[model samples]
Target: RIGELFEETNGYVYINLQLASYINDILTFLFAFCCFFGTIKLIRLCRFNQRLNLFIQTLQYAGKELISFAMMFSIVFISFICLFYLLFVSKLDACSTLLKTSQMLFEMSLMKFDAHELSGAAPFLGPFCLSLFIILVVFVCISMFITIISDSFRRARKNINNDQEIFSYMLNKFQRWTGLKKANEEERYALIRLEYFDPIEGFPERVDQLLDAINRLYMTQISERSRMEKDEF
Candidate 1:
């Protein structure tokens, strides 16, 4: 009956599809494993040689750029494939009459029936899907690698900024603590009088000298404060 023939045809088609998918999965896994391990090994070997390491680092940067471009490219490529497959290829091979006749002439015509149009779809789809799958997998891996590098660089920049801010803050605090405000005019004159009139042996007139330095520091502090406010504004 025609029903039996239709069932058999469907079975053959399912078998072919299943076989193609299996092969695609196997190929994709192998390609990913090899590419990943090979890249890591190449980087490790490059590290042992300074010149080679520089070369590899340069290559890695270029590779990342290319990979980003490829990801964008793959999106377009997949879109084209889907459009072609759904709108064009799927309409060609939905039916076949290759086994309907007994005569040699009928058989030849039947052979050409599936061969001329629908036959190429299976072969092309297998390779196309395999290639697309591989590209997507590699693209995702590259993107993740780039993301990690970007995050690390961002964190490093933040840390350096924080360290510089801390250093400046500590320096300012130390300067303020060690360098006192200058004394007034009267205070300066008093200290000068003390240095000349009250002399202590071996004490070095410490208080009077200290007062003079404090007077000078007060003037310097006012100048510095004006400069700081100007800079802030």
Candidate 2:
């Protein structure tokens, strides 16, 4: 698209671009996508990593909520786009076209819009609509979107498996097997006591600790009255 636009256009006397002229641009675009896919592949390869795995879990868990939000947002966003394009199409250059109006409104939602440019077009309707957009779209809709994602993220983080524990377990195992495990990490290891550190000893795995922790958290809190009665008795 960019190459087509940058092509020679002298009063519609279009001139074909030489391969050498736009080849660099074509290569750059291809390389950009290559890097992008490569990065995604790297992330996929390390999907077992703690934070990355959590983020993946969050998106998976929040799929329904995100889809609903996207639907609602599209309706509201498109409505405002038409509203702005209709009201300011003759006045404001930014809202001159449907696409431009949408772009401007997206910028507005991000708080990147210029109020002066909008207000200068239609003094009354411009500021009025701008303020309305700021209040409803920027504040209300965007905030709701954020709230939904955050709530979903909270649920995801809470329910997601603790991959960090698994990663640590694997790392420690590798280190131990290679005789490269650090003393500090050995000290931090709860599986085996420092005094009882031996290859022959019965070692409790990190998975057992993780299971116990999950059981503790999964159980409901004890009643205060029951505890008080037990203490009194």
Candidate 3:
């Protein structure tokens, strides 16, 4: 059918052009989404990155809250959708169908909705409902959503497992393999002797200063006693 469209035809063609076009569109849509999801899956391979790992951990911590938030959002959104659809179905083209109504509401939530048409339709109720939706969904619900993610991120950062060393090891190995970084003697020896080394230093600068002070005091006392004995003799 697509081939015939390219060729010069003089006769009456009984081709269902819409069918082929629709089929092509559906395939294109599926291909686009498949590519998107495949790219998202590849993120798991790069989890050695600290920022990416932290983001994943944050999501994991917020999973339950997000699910519940989704449910609450859907309920409120659907209620508004149905209400808008029923009230403005005959008056506004944007609310003529469920899909259009939902899309229009989403646009409203994003503050991209053109309210002139709606206001022209219902005069008072249109502006009132729009204000109500912005307050309830955009301000309140979205704010709660942000708060949930923020709290979860804070918790995740605080409670993150001490796998940072492992991630750093992976990154270093990868860099060395890619020739982006080289393994120096110090790093190599430190890596090898990591298990045998103590993480804390036994003698700090403060302890060294204290020892020097004690030695100076002892020397001063001894010299003073010798001077007094020599004077007495």
Best by lDDT: 3
Candidate number with the higher TM-score (1 or 3):
3
**Model 2 over residues 14-100: C-alpha lDDT tens digits?**
555687578978999999999999988787767678778878877887788889888998998888998999988898888888988
TM-score of each: 0.23, 0.62, 0.61
47-156: candidate 1 lDDT, tens digit per residue: 54444544445555456556776687567545544543453343443322222221212232233333334335556764454345445534554466567566545544
Leading candidate by TM-score: 2
lDDT at position 42, candidate 3: 90
Worst 10 residues of 2 by lDDT: 2-11
Separately for all candidates shown, the number of backbone clashes (residues 3 or more apart, or on different chains) is: 3, 0, 0
- For candidate 2, list the clashing residue pairs, or say none: none
Q: Give candidate 3 regions above 4 Å deviation.
A: 1-39, 162-164, 170-233
| TM-score of candidate 2 to 2 decimals | 0.62
Candidate 3: tens digits of C-alpha lDDT, residues 138-200: 999999999999999999889777567797878789999999999999987887887575535
Ranking by TM-score: 2, 3, 1
Extract clashing residue pairs from model 3: none
